[model samples]
Target: MHSRSRDLVEHAVTKVPAVTLGFWIIKIACTTLGETGGDWVTMSLNLGYLIGSLIFLAAFLVLVSAQIRARKFQSTLYWATIVATTTLGTTLADFCDRSLGVGYPGGVAIVFALLVASLAIWYRVEGTVSVESVVSARVEWFYWVTILFSQTLGTALGDWVAGEDRGGLGLGYETSAAIFGAGLVIIGLLWLWPRVSRTALFWSAFVLTRPLGATLGDFFDKPIAQGGLEFSRFYASGILVAFIAGCLLLIPQRAARRAARD
Candidate 1:
């Protein structure tokens, strides 16, 4: 009876997709697309970061609300929400780091604090910050907020470490991408070690993927003179969107199970 009840609860409540390679592939692509798409609106269209942030922020609000109201895990809705968070993150980060003149380091610090605070509060209230613990509306709210913070932090951190100074560390995008990619590899390896907490590894990888995507996005869209390919932002974003769509069609995903809550 207990097992049956547990199964029912798990099936009914877990709205997040199970962690899988396909999920990460799409996630990285979405993050890259976010950077390029956000740039397209803000730079290519001359809308500026403030205006871009407002537009993407509105989309995030609408999509996340729908995601929370959903009764079952819908892959399309979930991925859509993820993309919204990424785009919003990009614009919001740029607004803070450049427009506000806080610099990327300061922007990263602020967002990192917020991200940690969100996770801490969620852990305090829910007793777990695991994705599987995203079992209620409140938890879902916390989950999204944390995700948004992490995404924002990634953008700022990427710029701080790699972006050519609008205010950056001057590491260069290619080197920055390599560094972040290596970090992901280490996190992935640690995830296999039972002694290491998967939650920490998961969050680490999640944060790292953003910088990787950010650098990759810049590499694709920035001018060749600056060590980038100089592809048009819109063109790059369209390609990323098609790639994400293809992956969604080919890959399989389902709600996370209770057995391995990582």
Candidate 2:
């Protein structure tokens, strides 16, 4: 009884935001920013994927460290770290697919494997992979690592589904976005079933959001000839940043709750 009470208390100290509509809204916006912002650095500024990856990786490291050290959640810092991961994932995925000649299919395979491995290791070490269980530093480490792989995998999947006939099915960006959108809707329906596992649904939704944002981002920045609006990557990124900041101000974030009892 004592141990159970103590566990409940610790769970209340979660550092991540509660999974809510506002959370998903901000997350999608951030992922879109990741795509456009990453492209701006890697393509528009001609920095190349390797350089862009390194820059975002550095920022992720610094921000994650600060995040782990924080006694409680800081909305701005937390969201910034998420953006760092998305940007790093963007360039890193590109580096693997284009620079290393892995191709879109290979990049997706490699990153998916890493994501599964990260989750497996986390479940093994922590005995549970619940976000509400992330009150400890060790769990936080696993959480971030899993997110990194998932984000990278998302970029690869998006590119694979939307790329030209050379590597993908040649589906346009709009089609790819619609596909991922449907996936999210399916997951939402599953959530309504009492027999379904919430943890599984949560992760599925999380991963799908990335690809949805990726395709949307591509649609915003690619040339009109290629089915995009041809908007400036810099301009799109700025708009996304403003949208996220505004949402943060409008909706207060709260730490996630413990997963429902098994």
Superposed Cα RMSD, model 1? 1.6
Residue 148 deviation, candidate 2, in Å?
A: 0.9
Looking at model 2, residue 31 earns an lDDT score of: 89
lDDT of 1 by residue, 1-262 (tens): 9999877876564778999999899999999998999999999999999999999989999998999999989988999899999999999999998999888887998899999999999888877788877878898999999999988998888889997576688999999999999999999888889999878788888888998999999999999989899999999999999999899899998888654353
Global Cα RMSD, each model? 1.6, 1.5
Question: Candidate 1: where is the Cα deviation over 4 Å?
Answer: 1-3, 10-13, 259-262
Q: What's the lDDT for all of these models?
A: 0.89, 0.90
- How far residue 16's Cα lies from its native spot in candidate 2, in Å, is 0.4
Please write out the lDDT profile of model 2 over residues 128-157, one tens digit for every residue. 887878887898889998888888888888
In angstroms, how far off is 1's CA in candidate 2?
A: 8.5
Model 2 spans > 4 angstroms off? 1-11, 260-262
Local error of candidate 1 at residue 185 (angstroms)? 0.3
